[model samples]
Target: MSFLQRYKAGIGLGLYAVGIVIGLLFAILVVWADFEAYDFQAGLSVEQKTKGFSCPLAITSNESGLMTAEISNNSTRDANATVRMMHTLGSALVVNQVEQRLTFSPGQTHKLSWPIQASDAAWDRFIMARIYVVGSMPPRSTADYCGILLINSPFFTGQQILVFTLALALVFVVVGWRMWFVSNKQPAIDAEKSSRLMIAFAALVALNIFLSINSEWLASGPLLIVNLLLAVAVLANRLNKSTFS
Candidate 1:
């Protein structure tokens, strides 16, 4: 037997293994970079009693919502504070903002709220609500943020979408590997089908990476599942061809 026939199975298996490993590693790298870019109150002492904020963590696209902040003067004297609330798309553009100055007597607490809404264009993007308080002694300065999801699906939440995608990908990978190894005559890889699948997979990967980096995991999860399903269909078709031939 020539070299081509002698090690075809090995070559096929190697390709699949290498592709999966590289894809997973690339995904991890993208997630790591995004995490590093997130701001989690580094180098600041945050006191919840002095200044704190609350808002819904997730909302549908084009939905109206409210963001509230509570400021308290825990000290023995009166305090002057400036509180600012901002709504932004991703991290770059501010969509709405309000600023107010308030005076609080000792042991007094005041609550402030702002009306907020997410546009349809903000779907699959984060509606970031940030609260900044200045001129509060002991607290000095404080910041709080709420990341709202502009959800695309009403039936499923972001976490559910993510889990389903992962499970589907794993099933496809396992089934494809078994199909390749179980048959005595390994299926001949079709160049045209393989190329098309690769192109589709690459496109999805790029789009998913972009969405993930922007904290749009809910949007990317569906694409991830679709890519894996396409992969499974292509592999099954190729194997069936070999079986009939």
Candidate 2:
């Protein structure tokens, strides 16, 4: 009989260990991507206030590189607002200007938007959009606002992608060798113990699926702990003595 046929339980445990390690890697990637997205948001939001508009300002960017700003008017009269975009690195502006004009009624919330051809390299700099309220609208009613937007890029850089892929390949190769070759030396576990290990493995599989789908709710540290525990369980089962009695 083949070694796999003689040691089915050991084979299952080895397979489960490989799956657990892979799952851990995926969890790490998810957490890293989440932090990267947060950094982009923090870098792109402009907080400087212009003179003449007192209302709060919020800014967002779309996939097509369009930036939108929602400005609230606190004044009793309507006013025209001129919005302009600037890319700044350090103290100097780096790119061409884009501007738009919009009118906001008293106590009205106005959404101003404009499209731009922002390059991925632009993300390394600060891109800000300023709104200047024209006419007699004093800074007390509607303060001028500067909002920022950033260009989107891939979650992983070229070097990070290359390194991560190599690490994953190495893990797979090591785990594959252990599962197919080393497992042949392990004793055959009884059906009851095998069933119990399989049940635990299945539960972890389900948990991993849930975590992948709803990763935002839980921190990655906890996810990593769970994966480590799963690895321990599978490795323990792989080394357990086989006794039919």
Candidate 3:
């Protein structure tokens, strides 16, 4: 195919390939810089907490437990940052801890140390804590700490990977509808079809952006819903080809 012809047939594919490369590069950079640091306090997970907020984790067995987390800098940029922690304690036992804020710098390290003590009731509860960025809380309830999404199921995470599949399905629908089934009475069918594709593509794009920015808030179930429903839909349509014939 000529250059223009090839572009016409494959622009979407080309854009998708480019997007994948960029996303991979970003993820890799994060993994590389953070490989040695267990600094959970310096990440988006911690940045999602509200200001003047207090969340502490109840650590029962602090056999001289010292947790060190890396203050992550994705690039040459140095960000102004602070961290707060929250931990849940059992009803019988109370926890004694304090919230402290510290300046986080690039190419440097910050240390967090707290003493966790149990009451006479014997702390035996599974405690969970929330580490938040100072004044970095998300306005949406759907957003977990710092818009970080929790993926409990492999099925849901799979939805993120197969995201473009739905858009492709929608594309085929429009193409088939236009070529064979659109009402010619609608003189604007071509433009309407193109507009609709653009809109669908825009929605897909928005889904992706939201999926990226607020992805940390999404659970695996939503992914499964989108994937399975689309899969069954495509299968049904395929099996009904003879009916259309």
Candidate 4:
């Protein structure tokens, strides 16, 4: 059995290799892409609100080690609305900064969580969290807000994840070079002559892995290159079989 056969590997290894490479690279990018993650909304409502009405909310940091905020629309009026949050890092907006629309319906109740960083840690710490509504006709009602801030999790994985980033970069380097014409073996023989496609596909696969691993990270271009290689490998295998059969 050849080395690949010993590993029970064929086209699958290409996919796995691409995955690992992308994951590692993504973790590295996440170390810097810590954008407070408040960009994605969790709630949206379509009601109108009155200026004087306020809502009551309870925010807390639980054993799960996440900062959570819970909002309840305690108003007589139907509050068709959209929700988002904003937090200042270090008590000022000049440094670490983040703001977002909340992800909740006027009649909906949900929580939002974030990894603690240089900015406002979470809803738990804030006594009164504020939210904005998009709809013109918001319910004339009261909303409540409360949040928790956990002193950065004791089991935070940032350090370990960062350590894995180096490996990802190395693999991406291989994929990148391969795509750039360092090797005669074209990853994408399926599309006639497509070295560039292989590279692109490799890069995307790497990016997917990066996101999976980082859970906190975003992809740099290197990850995309790695996944592109994986795609190329898959494409190449299919082409070889068709030619022989």
Best by the lDDT measure: 1
Instruction: List TM-score per model, in order.
Output: 0.44, 0.36, 0.28, 0.30
Question: What digit string (tens of lDDT, one per residue) describes model 1 on residues 162-233?
Answer: 455445554544444443444315234654455455545655665765665445545655655665576678
lDDT of 3 by residue, 58-92 (tens): 12232212222333333344454555554323322
**lDDT for each residue of candidate 2 in 1-245, tens digit (9 for 90 to 100):** 46555575356445645655565555554443333333331233333444332211111222234445666666899876655544333222344455566677898776656554334223442343334333334443222322232323445333344346446644653454445443444345644454555455545544653454333414544755776776676566545734322
- Arranged by TM-score with the best first, the candidates are 1, 2, 4, 3
Off by over 4 Å in 3: 1-48, 51-130, 133-202, 216-224, 242-244
Query: Model 1, residue 36: what's the lDDT?
Result: 34
Candidate 1: list runs displaced more than 4 Å. Answer: 1-51, 89-91, 120-124, 153-245
Clashes of each: 0, 9, 15, 57
What is the model-wide C-alpha lDDT for candidate 2? 0.45
The CA lDDT at 204 in model 1 is 69
Q: Which candidate number has the best TM-score?
A: 1
Is 3 or 4 the stronger prediction by lDDT? 4
**Sort order, lDDT high to low:** 1, 2, 4, 3
> For each candidate, what is the lDDT?
0.56, 0.45, 0.35, 0.41
Better of 2 and 3 by lDDT: 2
Instruction: RMSD for all candidates, in order, please.
Output: 11.6, 11.5, 14.5, 13.9
**Residue-level error in angstroms, candidate 3, position 66:** 19
Which tens-of-lDDT digit does each residue in 6-46 have in candidate 4? Answer: 23333433544555455544533343223333232224442
